[model samples]
Target chain A: AQSVTQLDSHVSVSEGTPVLLRCNYSSSYSPSLFWYVQHPNKGLQLLLKYTSAATLVKGINGFEAEFKKSETSFHLTKPSAHMSDAAEYFCVVPPNRDDKIIFGKGTRLHILP
Target chain B: EAGVAQSPRYKIIEKRQSVAFWCNPISGHATLYWYQQILGQGPKLLIQFQNNGVVDDSQLPKDRFSAERLKGVDSTLKIQPAKLEDSAVYLCASSLGLPGPETQYFGPGTRLLVL
Candidate 1:
């Protein structure tokens, strides 16, 4: 089974600061990775995905993630954080066979003004 | 394109009562999924369907939960004699179901509160 672990449960940052959400994945081989965002009382929206094509995956809202096989990490980052960026971020992994997708416990981001 | 749709954005029920939730996937999407998300926990896959056929439902508690996708487009999940643990958000998602990994679009989710 493929799974992802989010390193942080909560992260607080000042506005316009860099944001880093770490994620480590466990898989026997190359795995499909994704990032999703969920706002308060809203459905989850796909931020980005890496399907074994590119090492650097760019997502919406100026967010991006890098897939590093050596480290088994697919960490999400942003150069600058906006107030609207405060939300729950989830790291996702899907099995190679495409049976189902697994989501991490989620990292809650708080942007301070 | 319109995203997946789920009915009853919120529901309140007492223990031992029954409730049903409905979902409609994106147009022409062959794969649909249902998940249960408790507070402070990640969403757990309850069931998945590929064009009206069950692909994986090993995690679903079949004893009190039942789900059906009659025409491969609309789906429903029902809980009988609900328990307090059943209080959670039910999310519905759909994908194109191509040969490889695909992006899943999620619905607004139905929040159920079992008191």
Candidate 2:
């Protein structure tokens, strides 16, 4: 009953430019949201999480996401992009009190120097 | 602390061949999960184990796929008579059995290619 949709499959940005990866969700109850990054040939790393405590959440590597309940959105953003920031990003949502976590199709961030 | 560990970073076999992937979770973590990630898609949960007991496996293809966490520390996922569609990255993740909002730590994943 809970799912996540990533608006973009791929995004390209020049170095030092702002970056945004959009996501929308459908859940019956208040859900926990997370942003994870995966570098090539590497495992997924947690960027940040929202557990209903805060609407705006900051994460590692100058990344952050804002949880908008009214919009049913949790969009990841960064003020400036770096070469190392190029990776695949995923938006995740876990149904309330459920063990299964649903993930979006993912957005690949491309950094152009 | 060490992260989740998986074996056979890459594997290739014929469509009818069988393959197995292994995983070792972080110390003392009570939950382990197996996920299949196809190209350009997010990882999908194949099975979940809570301390050597099956918690959820609705998505697993039981006729061809099976998994087990015998000792609750390490786990294995096997695919028999594999199909081309089964070619994907098998990721292993583990997490503490906290009540809610637990972070699942992932492994580098085993990439399987069925030709």
Candidate 3:
């Protein structure tokens, strides 16, 4: 079975400050992890994906995440936060051979000026 | 490339009433998915289709929810005897096919309000 946990339900960051959203996952076998962002009234946009390629994955909109197998963590980060960066973020695990992708509860990001 | 398309951006219905949502996936994409997203939560997979065949639907409420992908192209999801808890956004997504299906493009989603 594969499952993902987003540590925070909401995160508030001041503009120009670093942003971090914590996520962890549990899987018997190796897993594929992803980070997706959703703006207001918009569909989800893929921020990054880790598929055994590299531990440090860089994605669009100056976002990045590092996959740590020992710690079982895949935390998203950015150097700075912008007002437009305020959105809902989700951590996802693709289906294993069993064929079922699991999603985290989601973290709502609030940018403070 | 054209993205996934969904109709009836918003719908308001009474409990126990039936409602339907339509979806048109990207051209040549053989995999389609339906997801339910409640407020303050991430999207949950409701069903998946591979070229007109059902792939996974374990989380769907078979008693009241059903979906069909006809001709391996467009699809529709119907909910009969809707419940208040069913109120959420129905998102339609499509991906290029298996054997390494990468990112799935999503539609705007239909927001349902059940009274």
**Which candidate should be chosen as best, given lDDT against the real structure?**
2
Give, for candidate 2 chain B, the lowest lDDT window spanning 10 residues.
Answer: B96-105
The C-alpha stretches of model 2 lying farther than 4 A from their native spots are: none
- The local lDDT score (0 to 100) that residue B64 gets in candidate 3 is 100
Candidate 2 local lDDT, residue A54: 85
Candidate 2 TM-score, C-alpha based: 0.96
Q: What is the descending lDDT order?
A: 2, 1, 3
Give the clash count for each candidate.
0, 0, 0
Clashing pairs in 3: none
User: Which window of 10 residues has the lowest lDDT sum in candidate 3 chain A?
Assistant: A95-104
Predict model 3's lDDT versus the native: 0.90
lDDT of 3 by residue, A1-95 (tens): 77889999999999999999999998898888889888887878888988899999999999999999999999999999999999999998876
Looking at model 2 chain A, report the run of 10 residues with the lowest lDDT sum: A95-104
What is each predicted model's overall lDDT from 0 to 1? 0.91, 0.92, 0.90
- Return the lDDT, model 3, position A106: 93
List the DockQ of the predictions in order: 0.60, 0.66, 0.51
The TM-scores, one per candidate, come to 0.94, 0.96, 0.94
User: Tens digits of per-residue lDDT for model 2 on B1-115?
Assistant: 9999999999999999999999999999999999999999999999999999999899999999999988889999999989999999999999896764346889999999999
